[model samples]
Target: MATIAPSPPAALIDGFGRRISYLRLSVTDRCDLRCRYCMGEAMTFLPRSAVLTLEEMAAIADAFVARGVRRIRLTGGEPLVRRGIGELAARIGRHLATGALDELTLTTNATRLAEHAPALAAAGVRRINVSLDSLDPERFRAITRTGDLGQVLAGIAAARAVGMAVKINMVALKGVNEDEVGAMLRWCVAEGHDLTFIETMPLGVVDEDRTDRYLPLDGVRRDLIERFGLVADAHRTGGPARYLRVPGTATRVGFITPLTENFCDGCNRVRLTASGRLYMCLGHDDRVDLRAAWREGGRDALDAAIDEALALKPRAHGFRIEERDAAPAVARHMSATGG
Candidate 1:
């Protein structure tokens, strides 16, 4: 007979007095689409062995739930690329059903959601976020290097059919898809999906010096009010995005400006890379490797490492133009980091 340790309570408030009830975990770095901003033409990827095993990921999530993390979102370069992901979601859902967790979600490019969303929803996932760069097929292909607009749209339809709360994340690139802001909002409204307009992060290939293609959230919202007569203000979501809405439509818009307005003060989530490294912030390279310690020290050692990483988190990320020189330290690009 085997004995299982008792799980921890389901709630714990962090130092910031924010209830730390949610966690986002990346299962693999493998992705089908290579967006220009996240991954360039040619980039090396981590070896298979370097990536954490499914069991390891579950154990980590279980530990997280034991520590009051009631909500978990499985992220990836494209999480659907990972084999048997539905099975992983099923296991997590089992824990959630047992009162250990309350919510389970997934974020993806929606290329595979049409085929996978039903099973994913059946396995306990209740929400999803799809990344759609642009509505123009040619522009989308150019930006993502692989445009399957029809398939992506079908995927969204499939997920919606399954009663999942759908949100679309569109990164507003200055010269690229900035022109589609209002159009994107209208499209999402027509489709009955929520829209989040993310200001390009100064991470990876996009930075302050690369201003030609960088679209600031403020400028976009200003233009929206002046030109299109749309109005935006903060919403009640306790996450990073400040929500907005079209003046006439039933659509809700959002601005996620990590560069212009640092949300670190309200940051409550932690990121675990595919290779089992914990990053305190998406802007910097500060991380603690739990993979190495896991094999030698077991679960207790891993918990201590996570605690130490959290303790080392800085009050805020004061990133500026000068900091571009050290951008490489911020883990891998968003694709590899499973952002």
Candidate 2:
């Protein structure tokens, strides 16, 4: 039997006394589909040589688990699209068997979930988050530029067949898919899957104006209350989505409002890039390069780099959408940081 390594004495606690328990480690920045909101139509992906090896990624996950990270989520431009992703997930999922990690989950576009669901389930992943902005086929194609709604729907079905709990993440866009929020909620309820609406964030330079598509969740919630009679739900899923449930229904609907409210007080997560750069806050540009540290002096050096990063963790990410032509707070795209 392979022996599990003992965690270090001190835990990863930020300057604001917020314990870092969750880590979103990105495997690859390369993705198949180019969503209009996420990136430009013509794009250049990071060179393969710039990305960290699967062995390095697994080792970093182990290091985080040792430093009190309870939840490890493998995020990406699309995690399932990466080669040998199942092996990487299984390597980190071993911590679940030892009780060192509480959850080993992932967020995917679901276009590739059909081929990976069985391997992921076998790797000890019980839950997954799927990014599905629209239920309509034509709208989906337009939004994603190269995605097939039928393929995504089939992937979702494949995930459900493996007894995996699925949550559909929909980005509520004004003049885009706002009219379908009500119908989307109904579909989620009928399909026995939870649905979450996320306000579009200003991440990178896209073809369209961010203001044009920014849809506030406050209006969406008011609509829900009137239509479905939503009851406030205290369902905490470790992420920043405040939940609500329709009266007498099992489905829990979530709203992630980053624009209308301050959702950073309870922030306990950090994003790690595929290149091993640890970003303490998504909206801020502060980061620590762990690849060089790990390659230099191994785990001890990597842990020290993590400690240095905790000191730089901001109290709150001051995310504000500037003027129509102004630059975003953080210049890098969401895909580069890990969606």
lDDT of 2 at 35: 91
- After superposition, the stretches of candidate 1 with alpha carbons farther than 4 Å from their true spots are 1-19, 205-209, 226-238, 247-250, 321-331
How do all models score by TM-score? Answer: 0.89, 0.97
Report the C-alpha displacement of residue 275, candidate 1, in angstroms. Answer: 0.7
lDDT of 2 by residue, 152-263 (tens): 9999999999999999999998898999999999999999999999988888788888888888889899989899999999999888999999888789999998888879
What's model 1's lDDT at 3? 100
Give the best candidate by TM-score.
Answer: 2
Q: Give the TM-score (vs. native) of candidate 1.
A: 0.89
Inter-residue clash pairs, candidate 2: none
The root-mean-square deviation over C-alpha atoms between each candidate and the true structure, in angstroms, is 3.5, 2.8
